[model samples]
Target: MSATQTAPAAASPSPASAPVKNSRGRVILASLIGTTVEFYDFYAYATAAVLVFPVLFFPTGDPLTAQLASFGVFGAAMIARPLGAVVFGHFGDKHGRKATLVASLLTMGIATFIIGLLPTYAQIGWFAALALLILRLAQGFALGGEWSGAALVATENAPAGKRAWYGTFPQLGAPIGFIIANGLFLVINFSSPSREWFLEWGWRVPFLFSAVMVIIGLWVRLKLVESSAFEKASTKGAIRKVPIGTVFRHHWKELILGTFFMLATYVLFYLMTSYTLAWGIKPADVETAQAAADAAGTPFDAAAFFPGGGFAYPEFVTMQIIGVVFFGVFTMLSGPIADAIGRRRLLIWVTLAIIVFGLTFNVFLMSGGSPRFAGALAQAFLIFGFTLMGATFGPMGALLPELFPTNVRYTGSAVSYNVSSILGAAVAPLIALALWAWVGEPWLVGVYLSVMGVLTLIALIIGKETKDVDYEEAGFSSSAVL
Candidate 1:
């Protein structure tokens, strides 16, 4: 019998059997917690890449170059993510979701913890930077499998018409993780007496604290049953022996569409988080500010040095926290709205909105008439960008999985998601920095953002609306050759 035509195995739960509300709730919780831990670990590194890694890991020269180098290391994880997706996607599709998730979690947790203990350039020279790069790769690798698995866990267990709502649970992790990571950094930043001391040791605390979050994630994920969809596929002997190859062979169209469909979302997020942090913390005319502070026998505080040029680090982080709150709120709202209208329809509208926002993004930054004005402008940029991000990103968990058949769902979704990261996220900060330095205009970056939004808009127009599709059906033909 053909794979799709095979009878359901006795070991598998019936696809038609209604999912219990309580069990579905558990799946959501498990998925949310797993993603939260993964992203917290991930974003912690990102924040440090800007605020600490440059000084700690590198032999400092120019601050901007060092910062760019740190961002390059940050991109290393994005570079490794697709490889992780291929490896873990195979296991997830062929073995099971829960097993793969647990393994990914362990890998990420261990790498993050090790990064905290790693020696800096002052202690170990180049070896310190090398170790940081290796650990960053490990973080990328683990996260490759994380998002797709968590998304599947939630969406697969969703009741009829609630997939979008369930999908948002995993999406919620992004804002929560951002808040937690930044909040901890803020606490440490304030409590410490000296910037030198904080840079020396206080930053490591967040990375080390990841151990606790990982333990919690593991405990929750361990309790999760494999999704009924995967179990059903397994029982019917429908699991692809090499899921990555199978997806590439059969689902190439969905893969391409899914990747581009996410371009704007990925670009907007990294731009707002990492790139914005870099821009905001930069001292306005570094030499002038440093000279004034030195003449006064005080250290140059970038936050106060250039009232019209750059933000105080602490003030900018606080604004970002506020923006993240808006991100979280809109993320929750997007789900129910998506459920009401349609994922594709909402995405098209949101992408269009992002294009408009991207074009105007630099106006606020340019209007730094006063410190207060600059801060408000920065907050507006973040709140508006994140609000649009929520609408764009919120539907992705449901949208990606729904695009492919269950047999290759994990591989397909993971590859698409990670590939988009490489395309949009991995190089965004680097590109933004280069644009700002070379062209000397922030609006150019806005134009770049708008271009990505246009790309996504085109992809959405070309792709099918999948919200109404029956996810339980093995949508592919049994006669299809692998």
Candidate 2:
């Protein structure tokens, strides 16, 4: 089943439903837009978890404890993700990808918007914390269903030999969303009259702004026709009554391999964004923090202070934005390369690079030598790390769904991605933070990343290449059904 021979068949319309024919541009746009909103809402929360949530939601005497608790709430959402996957995956596999994508986007947008309006711990007491956790769970659940649908929208609609290339469009959403979310925060942080002003109101802006983004995303998605793959599945009477049962019963190997396959990507993503931001902007020494606290008429606890890169918020974030540019570039590049070679082969090499990158964390992060020298090294670390992030991430959009038939694809891919979130994203920030706090350095966290990368490499070794999957035929041919 060479791709060229099967691709034309995949695109041919069925008599069951007249295909509205999602145009090339429309397919790319719909795929890119939903995930963009998802990530924007997500990164907004991640950023606040570092800058504002600790002080506002999880206030405690010990800075480390407050941060850990804030991140604990952050991780809690990852736990809800798998459930979201099951619920949404069920509907998506049964109903259609278009409606499911719209539902997921709306869920996330509403949750994020309400979080902006919720009272803080000072105003509403622990209820504020409870509300935040519930909303975070909603956000997680929405995202659990969002990625796979978008990936399917792109890859399922893609032309032969170019599935991976079209897949890159959805992956592009991450860097774009990161830049937009953080860039907006950076702007608000700079524009506020004082740090107090920013803390009081500025952080809420990004969350509330998501409503507008959601409206635009919904419009784009509503315009999308069902992907050809889903139509092919449906027209052939392959739609399952319970996709979850079908997936677990028959595609158990894919579920397991796909979960571990995504392990390193999730770990690296959180580490590079959340953990790095937390560590990148901290005061390098207790004396500096105490001095700032004294000037601001705030109490300082020396016991809770930990050294970091010593860079200011603006300076460090600016560097991160620069690194993410390379992320976007390499993400786009990785797809074409994967299309030329194969997903498994490219990923194996990239995983090896990640393993090597993990070992060099101290080389870039150790806070010695002149401040200028240190800043240069930190910038290099971000650039290098995100470059790897893009390479590893881009192929996943096509690769994951290609592992399953169209009938169970929504369930299969979503389950794998979000389940891995529990293993990787759910804990990476906490683990990195704990190791950083315990050892007073970031080298151990890097070692953690390397270990995860090794796990991904093993998954890659065991998995088969799917560049030539006949998506049209993969559905309904299997006799296994629940």
Candidate 3:
């Protein structure tokens, strides 16, 4: 059957029938709160991996090598995400969305809290790195399950004609989480009397504070009922015994299309946040700066001549926070726009915008001559890149869930979302770093991003527009054999 076909009469709900609702506000709140905590935990680790983990976790060596190793640990979480999806997706589809959401939250929160207490290399040698790896994997695993459940909860309970808007509630978590995570680090970066103190102990505060956030998230999530859609499926005996297997056997096309459709968004997100942090804070290359100055017959001022020297960590993060505000705003706006235009159309236009942004993104970064200029350029990149990110990411919560039947929605969506992380987000920073080091060309990274955009644009062209699809009926009449 075609993806856009209506469900047959025996299984599908009538178009005139009202959608069942437990509480729309409660569902959106539960999804938003849980996702905010999940992303907060994830972003905290990303920030630390860039700023502190190299010095604290790895052997003293070339800073570049150590930074790569830290990112490798970061990628470890992304690698484990798919496995988490499979495990949690099984229970989420077989049992219920509520219980699965609660379990994933606890797993992520405990792992983040433990990371705060872990010993550094000086204290425990290689064992410290090993322990860090284990905790990071736990985090990835939990997040694997968290996002799909949150998206489903919001979309499934959403009123007819408003799934995209409701879906943005969960998408809202990305910027909010980034702001909280970076805001905390910014506080620690300035509050400490010395850099050593900040690196050694101050960084732990955010990770440790995750314990409180997790409790709050759980409280909010626990208050939610299972999604109305899932409840309906269960009542009708539509719930699958092995959701993952069913997804692979029946929805493989959507699984592949969804993964590639999200590739550019993931790539752009990590590059903007993680790789930008790495690039901005790296120490000035004095030799290279001197060469350029001598060749131009201008006196070398270390601050003005080197790109890295011009960027201060606190100031850069503050700029990112400002940009993230716009990201959140646009994220909210993208939903209504998708409702009006269509998810596929909105995605195509925004993705094309990303390709344009990617081609010129390096120009802004390379144009930094003074501290003021550098800060302005950084802000420009963040605002522009994140605007596109918001538009592309906002509709995803609705789009992915709409792609599959209700019986396999959680498993299909979770696997597609997490599997993309492995292909895109898991190694994006690592790949960008390698490109920066090997070719010493920032535009190459832009080209790389554009390539991902092209892939996603193609996926969009080949995929159906799902904004008008009836979520209530799409999943109930699947043809897959048991």
Candidate 4:
């Protein structure tokens, strides 16, 4: 008999057999809150790199070079993420998700708090940057293990028929975290006086405040049980001795496919959040600057594009918070939609939408905005980018878990997800920046995302459909009789 033939039929646990409601809900809650804290810490660094780090930690003779250095440190965390995934995934698969989740959250919180305390280059010279780098690496390492545990928590406890919807609950963390990250900064920015005061201390408030959320996340996570999937898998002694090696041996193609399939999603994220902010702040843009400077407590030439003829970055940062709200609403709706349509299909359509809309949005961006058109167009494109992100990212909660057997689901999905992050998200903002510098135009960067979208579209179209398969029955061919 073939593997499918020998495998038991996919089954859902009944009320008597299913994970009890309180237990499952607690697990989902833990996953959601834990992910929110993790991503909150992660995005806070990303935001600082853009808004404050270039001036604070990496003071330099040239403003441009300082900006590059700030981004360099931001990219460092991405490079560390996959390595963290491998190390943490191994222990997670071998031991349990509960322990791994708690460890990662603690590590992230500590790293972020330390970042808030680091001295600036003015205060401590190069040592400040060194300290920041070390903390960023710690944050990356913790994040590597975070997603896998989140995925497992939601998937393991979900009702079989509603797994896709439940899985999306963990995925909601990205937007929620973004909202909290940007909202905190928005509050600080509004309250501060000059850029001097903001950089002097306001910048650290968000990082220090994370300790409160971390404590809350930890308490919630502690109440959850170890995943039922992990419990069952452990009984069979099926945990891999080394997750990375096992993934390459047994599921190399799927890993590669997932990496490509997720490429466009990450690319769009950088484009909408980081790249748009860059374009808005560059000296060439007059109006965006004027708006920003006014929002700041600074005076400028009213005749200048900005008050002074330079772009103000903080105003755009406020816009990003608004964008996060739109993303949150769209993401919430995408979960049930994915459950109805299937993961693979949703990914394909979204990838196509990104390609088509990405090109059009660039055209709209290049056409200098009129006062009446700017807000509507910008919000529309922001929602467009995030809605595409939502459609693909929402189903991922179910899709990644469904790709692996319960025996090693935690390890396998974590590795693949983080590996995808490295290839797709880790370098995305850097690459887009590099592309723009290389070609001297944003259109070239759009082409880069378009190409990635096409690649991911192909991957989704060619990949096997996974809607109905049970976790244990995943990755087997339908041709194999059960």
Candidate 5:
């Protein structure tokens, strides 16, 4: 009797008898598919904001004014994200991750699909821009909850010692979604009979097509069981009556640290995707830009204009896609490296590298003396920037949520992540454009990125390492922790 041992938890557990565990594949698919749809919808809107929305929705007679207006609408969504975070996080932290994720996906998908159907400024006057703003806010709201849920679903379910590695699955969605969305846009651009028709009808395809991906994501996510960490928190009666209140009262320091931890990532990501596209694709010479404006029937004011790097849309997109391939690869690579070392240690080095990289933007971008030379420099810049993007971004999937305890993980992480979105993502493109025009080059934009990185590094130095934190560790039950 003294030597007899009780059976392990799995000794008598069968598929039907035991608790429903989220399999690796199911967890990966659920997290990956949700964010894929989320980012795809986001990137499609971002691309359209740069390419079509300025002309179709703003139509302000001045290219820069119209572009700035479009970015204003774009930034509106970021403003709504924290609200979405609070609402969604309340449900997620108290109820479960699966339902919150499904709700977010549905919200984003429907908003995007409706955007495809909205009338342009040419047809509905300013109402069209108003409708676009509303829909963009909905997208932002859905995304606020979507990311934290997905990251938690992945990392909380991960086997011991592999949270960072598993976290990359959802992070992978960024590059995959970007490629698919942009690839489809490129196809529409090539296949359309006329530029006018493409501008009018083709831009709607990606937004409308989000419906299909949303359906697929729903199917995958519906199969997910609530994560074990959430179950344990619930079992221990640690589920707070209001999770965000607990987070604010007890975890305020982590909340601040997590927000800045993500500041550089948001700034760098938007700069790479949105700012660079606007900066790289415009003609550097006024004559070509004016001629292009004339061909498109858009009004141009050459006397007050500043031109861009002069790369054709297809050439630049191909270059960006190539760089994004590096983005996807390095994203996968960063996980193991972070896991093998530690998230804090690896990101410190990457942050320093980002700081250095940002200082050198003028070397590649401003030195485009000849067409051939310019193309090479631009492509190199895209590659290096996006490579840094992947490395910095991949770790965030684990880093942000790990800052909080299980009971308030969703609320804390979402608030932190989305609040940073307001500071960084919402304003990066607009600020970059103004800086590019004011200073007459892209160097200030690079300095903008470096400053953000420096802030992020300072936060990292102040914050503690999250790699050693246990996802399933006991959570606070309306209690204080030092």
Candidate 6:
């Protein structure tokens, strides 16, 4: 008998049996919590890179170079993601989603905790920077494995006819994590006495708090059962022999489509989060070093005077944190909206909005006014941009898994998602930094979003719509031979 024929009937459950209260809800909760913790760890680094790292790790005399170096470290995680996807996805397909989900969370938590404890550049010289880099790469590896398992958990447990709607649950982690990550920093920024006080201790609080989030994520994930589809695949020995190779050999087209389709989403994310924070600092009234100089009576050059060592101003940190909360609110609304409207249609519209908004973000920053007004504009832009991101990002939970078959779905979806991370999301801040420095005009960064948006549009136009497709029957078949 074929491997497909060897499993219990639950392996092929109909839509009615897969209701939200059944196995479906348990799987969605597990996947959502796991991804939330992973993103919390990952995005916390992005927040730190913008607000603290240039002062802490790379203390070059030139502010621009130091900031770029900080962003370079931020980009390192994306570069490591694809490699992680292959390694973890291979095992996830062969072993199961539960194992990979658990391992990825533990790895991310350990790396993030180490980041909280690392000695400053002053204490260990170059070693502090080295430690941060190693930890960032580990975070990347963990994230790489994270999405595949989370997505599979949702897709596999979803009701047959409404998988797209349920699968989107894991995707909610992006915005929810964004909310918690930024909200914690906002609290820290507001609580500090002087900007100097904030830079010295405020930034570390968010990274340190990650231990609690990971614990919660682990507890929830531990309760999850193995995905019904994967359980069946394992019983029959139909899991891809060499998953990545199998994907590359047989389904390269879908992989490529998935990569481009995801590019606009990723780029817009980094632009809104990391790039927006960078722009806010360079142009706003807050002296990144004002707090240290006020107390020390020395002219504080931020690149020369790292935080944890000291800071220049404090009020501005609160403003930035407020802006992040706006981002979180929009993310919360995206999942259900995508379920209501198809993923493809929503993504196309949102891609266009990002292209337009990316350009407008710089315009608002460059236009002069009281710092308060600029802060308001910044908040509005971030909220609006993240709103569109939520809309399209909502659907990807279902869309990716629906693109591939059960046998190699884990591997294929992972490659597609991580490859998009490397190409679009991971490199975005670095690209934005380079463009801003190279031309002295941040608007050019919008051009980057526009190009990717156009590509996403084209890809979606040519792609299949999986809104109603049966999960078991999605994507192409893998031949028994590799």
Q: Which candidate is the best by lDDT?
A: 2
Rate residue 115 of model 4 by lDDT. Answer: 92
**lDDT scores in order:** 0.83, 0.88, 0.83, 0.72, 0.87, 0.73
Task: For model 6, name the residue pairs that clash.
Answer: 55-306, 195-313, 195-314, 289-312, 290-312, 291-312, 291-313, 292-311
TM-scores for every predicted model = 0.90, 0.92, 0.89, 0.86, 0.93, 0.85
Query: Whole-model lDDT for model 4 versus the true structure?
Result: 0.72
TM-score of 1: 0.90
RMSD (Å) per prediction: 6.7, 6.2, 9.3, 7.8, 3.7, 6.7
Give the local distance difference test score of model 6: 0.73
Residue 238 of model 2, lDDT score: 90
Candidate 1 error regions (>4 Å) = 1-22, 282-309, 475-482
In model 1, pairs of residues that clash are 303-312
Model 6 per-residue lDDT tens digits across residues 1-482: 77667676637787776633326557767878877887777678887886667767777656677777888888888888888888888888777777788888889898998898887676676788989999999999888889878888887877655566676678778767877887787777767786677667778888889889889888878777776676667666677778888789888888988888888988887887777666655423246465553444333365432321011223444454455555445544554555567667767777777767766746655556776676666556656776777666767877787677777787888889989988887678888888876876667888888888888888888886666555554224732211
Give the per-residue lDDT digits (tens) of candidate 4, residues 18-119.
553336658668879878887788678877876667656665645556656777887788778787888778788788877888998899899999899988
TM-score of 6: 0.85
User: How many clashes show up per model?
Assistant: 1, 0, 2, 7, 0, 8
Better of 1 and 5 by TM-score: 5
